[model samples]
Target: MTKLTLGVSSCLLGDEVRFNGGHKHHRWLTHTFGQYADFVPYCPEVAIGMGIPRNPIRLISTDTGTRAVDSMNLTDDYTERLQHYAESIVPQLDALDGYVVMQGSPSCGMERVKLYNKNMIPEKIAAGLYTGVLQRHAPAIPFEESGRLSDPNLVENFVQRVYVYHDWRTRQPWRTAKELIDFHARQKYLLMMHDYPTYKRLGQKLSNLKDIDNRGAFGQAYLVELMAALSNIPKRGHRVNVLQHVMGYFKNQLSEKEKASLIHSIEQYQASEVPFIVPVALLKHYIFLHGDQFPYLMNQTFLNPYPEELGLRNPI
Candidate 1:
């Protein structure tokens, strides 16, 4: 297994590194991920030499591109320095598989960041300082926000993307069309759950590529399409939908008595509004108490999303 090294905003880990010395610590993250991956904590404000409890900055739209201006004034542009520092540090962060940033911050928010006008008026232009640069530098990395992590779907997809990214990197000297095909197949269910049309279009793109003589160029194009194929899939809601279908497999395997207890809980899944893991866990407790009737429930879709061997229960 390729251990994913994830970078996160230091403030989101309850670190008192925010501009006002407050943190946006997400408990679900620090508790669950703290044990799984290597977290490289970063505070961009401090990294750019701005200390804690310093003046705040917001994104501004001048005649030029979006600029980071002092929230208190419209004259000063602090983003040139942030841009320079980002270009330098982005190269050194070559090993990260994913990043989780604090949303709505001018410096780190991934999207919908506040953009201001020259008149010091807030506009709806969404932009983030470090986020755009980091994404441009590492296009393949999985990135999301602290708030978005609460949705189990985004968490599952983020985890899958991180693992896949690491897996792609490990297949050094990626050779043969079959390798590309297998990777794409593995992502099939994820694509279906997210964007059905985009998923369909990506399949066409992959199928109709021009035959080139050079193998290296073809492989490079393959990798690009692999990322492009996944691009349309919205990372959040689709992931949850996939998880719920996977949970359904457990329901089908239950005995008459066990099924009776879980049928109502399982029915809630039809609305697709509640968390699948919640009801799935209830079913597991009801069945596992029997101790041997459905021992393989541990290996069921409710338990593992990605298995070494394909189970008919898996959605993809």
Candidate 2:
């Protein structure tokens, strides 16, 4: 399989590109996810001609608007420079499947970047100028902060979206309705875990693809809905529900003892007594045993989204 291209902050990869000549290196990013990612690292400050060991910058709210300025010398505003650099860089990021940004940076933070008032008092928070521009340009690509990846659920969701988006992009220019339907069908359970109602709505929309005049338009519309539905982190309850739905396929095949064990494992997961892997393992065992009977369940992404070595769902 082709590695997914990802946009990452240079400092996260141990590059000494920060203002203080230090790096906020993340070991997991370099050693684990790095293996599957073709990381394209960038530092907005450096890209905008800021020198290493330079004065720190902050976002300041002015009568005109919010501006990024040197904290030491408020007169030195790099707002336009940063914004212009971000605009230029966004075009090149079209092929990236996702982005990983540094947290709490005036130039790169994705959310809650401090915004100061005219008196230099922080009054509110907003996204960093570069990330704000990136969001506007490529809202489809999943964006997450390095800090947030510590949460197992967030890590799982982010990686899942990245791989799925990469697959969708690589298999593009769908020439026939069957290709579109097959793609949608393969991702059915993955979508259900995120938002069941949106999943059903998307299914209905996809089912009517034949009636639409333009297949490209139909595909784009469905892609938008599909990504939107998978944006939210799937709750444990939602996942348990999906597992039960899978079990329904083998309702007549499984023996009474097998059903009891499967239900017990699922209930344990629902009650937070065990990690998500427990129930998933049992379900996969049954699916493998009855391989010829349940082709749909066998192809579900929920069974194994990312690599097992990542252990994204082991904790939750």
The residue ranges of model 2 lying beyond 4 angstroms of the native Cα positions read 215-218
Candidate 1 residue-wise lDDT, 1-316, digit = tens? 5456888989988999988989988886777666567788888788888878887988987687888877777576778888877787686556776788998889888888878776767865574888888878766667888877766555665665666666665664546655555555556555665566665766676565444435466655655555554545354355455545544545565677766656655556545545555554665575566535544444332244432231212121
**Would you list the clashing residue pairs of candidate 2?**
276-316
lDDT of the candidates, in the order given:
0.66, 0.86
Task: Give me the candidate number with maximum TM-score.
Answer: 2
TM-score of 2: 0.94
Model 1 stretches astray by more than 4 angstroms: 197-316
Local accuracy of candidate 2 as per-residue lDDT tens digits, 18-55: 99999999988989999999899989999888899999
Instruction: Point to the candidate with the largest lDDT.
Output: 2
Residue pairs with colliding backbones in model 1 are none
